[model samples]
Target: MIVAIAHSRAQLGISAPAVRIETHLTNGLPAFNLVGLPETAVRESKERVRSAILSSGFEFPSRRITVNLAPGDLPKEGTRYDLAIALGILAASGQIPHAPLGDFEAVAELALTGELRGVRGVMPAARACQQASRSLIVAPDNVLEATRVRGVQVLPAATLSALCGHLKQTQRLAWAAPAPPYAHSNLAGQPDLAEVRGQYFAKRALEIAAAGGHNILLYGPPGTGKTMLATRLAHLLAPLDDEQAYEVAAIHSIAGLHRAPGQWLVPPFRAPHHTSSAPALVGGGSTPRPGEASLAHHGILFLDELPEFGRRVLDVLREPLEIGRVTIARAAGTVDFPARFQLVAAMNPCPCGYHGDPGASCRCTPEQVRHYHSRVSGPLLDRIDIQIEVARERNWLSSTVTAQLESSASVRARALAARARQWARQGKINHHLSVSELSLHAPLDRPTEKFLAHAFEHYRLNPRTYHRLMKLARTIADVADCPAIAQDHLSEALALRRLEVAPAWPAGMKH
Candidate 1:
């Protein structure tokens, strides 16, 4: 045979797009040519494939060789195509049967010794192959990740010769067993809510945030346990469903992150440092990759020392916070990554970290405090559903105080019950309810309406803020297991909007 074809996949964002590997041998001077919009790494695969094929005891055709990755418009950028390219060359050279390549897709890197190596984004490729109703061939290193996708037939190959032997019927590769079932809940290593000494209000706000998937900001003096409170919020969250777990796993896989099998269903928690760039916070680059926001999909994204991050970097989160995805556009194309993360941020009241505390004297003028708070934009603040203050607990170290604190399991039980109510009532979480849906699910009586209107006008809330306030009230009511938004719920929701009140910082200072 002078020509042969093999199937493979390319990683684009979290998606695996099909790429056809076409190889041909012609009567001419000995040379190898690769065509398609292949990047540096993929271009280097030619040498790797040549070495791998020779090392596998296969004859290298001396005729001119040409390889093309079809759908030339889509850019190819990884070593994942090496195995398929080598297989195509062998098939075209009549060293392996080309007929058997029709039923399978391969994605793995090739070593100089003809051994197969694992590549990133195997989970996505496995899913795509399963959807296409084709079996997948991968290295032993990727077998577990590929098998994680249910119903995908994964054949683990150790070397090119072994795979060729299997294809020729001289030997057979065993199918990998399916991965173990995902655990529904994994709070084993999570910090318990009871570990936090005090800050009942902060704990309540965290509970509300987890129950309804609301974004929260916890601001206070240093050593007030804001970070501690933020870390515990993920444990209170409900486990991801099967589909969500797969989505989360695929995103992490694309980013080259792996977690223990037991933690597959547990919500992800990501805390990027203040020094992280905008692209690092939101996914972006010459070749776009999943950033921290995308990594936190179906989970929590906690930003400690929130104001310490660049203002522009923080602003980049506004879009993903509003819509549950981040769209990064480059000259090549635009990629969208799922970023439906529940944001939990911690910050001090001032640069000196003790502006409002009675125990410490103010170090700078009010302007410094205003400027520090202004680093966080108003639009960004408006998108956050709950903004509460964490205060210092003078006697929290006392044994008496620790005994009264609730455990994470207890809080998670209540939070789960609240979420169940939300799901039953509106078929979605309170945080995701649209304005129209809110009217139907969270109707308010006349008195409560009047009370909310007075507070809204008094605070000069924007439409977005008003809607978020309503969502927060609905969440509060759900936590209380109430069917309707009550006056008390509205009142508590308003109070949780710490920026809406005076003296915390001037309301005008937010802009």
Candidate 2:
């Protein structure tokens, strides 16, 4: 007899349609064989299936049993196939009826005593099952995560025996309804923007960055609240919509970092340490997974102490920053992860941290200062849309002033209004606008056009940097509620770009 059960495996960014698990009893020496390019985890599921069958008081067939994961060309990984394999063997041996197994997509990792364990990427698997119009049988531990996807009949199984009992009509498992997703509130653990004591210029730049989904770089001496301000940017972002929530949650579940009992509603804030490797920051493994950048998708990626990281590691992010996705090609195949994130990086002016500080004198030589700043490549700096220098002032922090600054909630309200206006004017946000779209929507007025032409010649700006400056100016215009980008907007945008001018190369080194 041969018994086949249906399952699924995630490939690239989506779940492949279906993988049928078939167990056949054939005449040969007593041994078990698994086929269909099963990875080590899938192959190892055999021992677990055997132990679980016997420990659950089911007979293990003595004949040579060959288990084949159908659609043989498809590469299968993970312990997700354990339950399907076990059920196929049981139904082949005629212990459990095959009719019930045919209706549901069974996915779980089984222990020797038949206890079902949780598996990764359950959210995506559940969604796939729903799309296929099939029921999902998940381990009790995974039910919490799986229930995040609605419109699916979720049967949470405690153990393999429990599933068998239910399928055989001896007992039944309870159905789990979808869990309501939770939204992150500005009043929660988040710090308010009003708490930032000073640096109004930096605060305004933060507003523009959040409004346009632009990347920002803050260069200043130590203790200027660059890190402090970056942390509050998420609070300024509007809450994720339902579809965006599920997308973010699904990525987190696959990464095994989903928050318990609730979903992430607000944009996620990921601050990977400077010591993170290229793989850890960008994401890769034997089985490629979402890295920090992808995990920060639809959210913020904050890098403090920017120049301290490996130049190569920082360089790895340039491609994703441009394309909004990261592709990791392996022997298995190519897996692409979403890398659309707003980047906020902070750095010191020099190695000694006092190059331009009004509060202190610099010790580093000119060459040393140049080397320290040069660690950040020109190409990377060009990608950053807004750049600002934070100069220290103690008056804002003094006891005499008690006036309140705008809270994150207030700032977010203005930001949402600005975003709605921009999106309505252009189909997408300002940051996503292409060159053609920019020409149509942000056509510069005569005065602004003349100002940009003069600045381009004086500052020696490249075409890429010119586009970035115009985009930033468009964002500023959006926030100002102006019908057309004006000369002041272009002037302000150019001021930000000129804040940190890269060192001029030696006479012969100019490209």
Candidate 3:
């Protein structure tokens, strides 16, 4: 008899529907075959499944066993299908009953000893099972992530024997429940805002950036603590809500980064290297996986040494930054991943890395400086909301200016209050405000209106830049604890836009 069990595979994002797993036994050449668009990882799972079943004391039937992951046209990837395939084979060979397995979705990896190892994207898989009104069975290691999805029965198994025992009614597995202490308190080695000295303007900009979910560009000479400030900004963000935490954990789980059995309540901070490829940064392959941007959803993606990144790689971010999602199309199918990330990039003024520093002389020629600046396209720069130059502190490395700075806890308190105000008034963050909505929410005063009109034509700002200006203004208002946008807010907003002022290029020229 042929045995088929239902399981799922994550394509681009966690919320997508799952691929159906079908196992069939046919009398043929006693060969094992996998159909559907299986990637290299899925194909390799056949070996692991076989080894796991034999090691777990199950007989490998000497019949033609064909495993099919349907929809046959959709591409399947990763080690997530190992346990599902093993279970399907066991059921097909009459070693395990198919009755208990039919009502649940099972996903896990298997070791040679039949130990059920955790696979990536288990959270999303559990969510899909719950939405389809089926119970979710996952590896014991993935129980923490799967439990994040509420209203779902999460059955965690540590080994193949445990799973078989549960299915055969010999023993019952404990159902996964919501993890208590949703807010994370332990920030191991997390940077603190209090440690940063001076640069109050930069600190304020960081605060505003956190408040509005805006992208920030910190351009200055080296050793100005740009990276240090960016690292600490995550601490100021409000803890992720239960739903958002689940989404984040799912992405981390799918990316194989969620190894611990606890909550990931804090916002994620992903700082990819400058040399990261477009695929790794944006996510693409034969079988699609979430990239750095997708993993950083509802969080921060910090790119230090921004200009050093490949021009093409940097350019790939424009689409996801604007739309809050990334889609990868292959011959098998197209998959979309959520990429609503706050871009926090930092760089020096020029290749010599001291173009604007008062403490150090710039070694680069004018042409070299211009070329270095040109590496970052004007279009990408326009998307950034806060652009501020940080000058090196006067005391080189010796002076210790000791004044109490606001703690991240206090800053986060203010930030959440500000965020609540914005959400209450506009139904979203300032960065998401539409043009007509901005006219009402961030209504410029007479003088500010005139300034923007003149600046738009004189500076030849694009519509996106125009909207970014208003968004920055709204953020400024939010930081000031003001109910309405004010002239000072508009002025502060324009100040940040001055980072776009650089050596002029010809019309239509981009990075």
**Winning candidate number (lDDT):** 1
What is the TM-score (0 to 1) of candidate 3?
A: 0.88
Could you tell which candidate, 2 or 3, scores higher by lDDT? Answer: 2
Q: 1-511 in candidate 2: lDDT tens per residue?
A: 5655646554445343478887888777888888885557655787888899999889998888888887876656757788888888888778899887778897788887899988777888888888888899988888888887878779998888888899899997789977874645445556888888878888888898888888998878898888999898888887887777777777788787775543367788899999999999888987778888888888999999999988889998998899988998778677888888999999888888888676799998888877777778777777888888776877887765437777888788778888998889987889999999999999987777998898888767766777888888898898899979998898888766645334432111112
Per-residue lDDT of model 1, residues 195-263, tens digit only: 898788898898888889899999888888898889989899888888999999999888878866888
Candidate 2 stretches with Cα past 4 Å from truth are: 14-17, 260-263, 400-402, 500-511
TM-score of each: 0.96, 0.95, 0.88
**lDDT string, candidate 3, 307-381, tens digits:** 899989999999899899889888756788889999999988888788756668988887888778778888788
Worst 10 residues of 1 by lDDT: 502-511
* Model 2 per-residue lDDT at 420: 92
Scored by lDDT, model 1 comes in at 0.89
- In angstroms, how far off is 114's CA in candidate 3? 3.1
lDDT of each: 0.89, 0.81, 0.79
Name the candidate, 1 or 2, with the larger lDDT value: 1
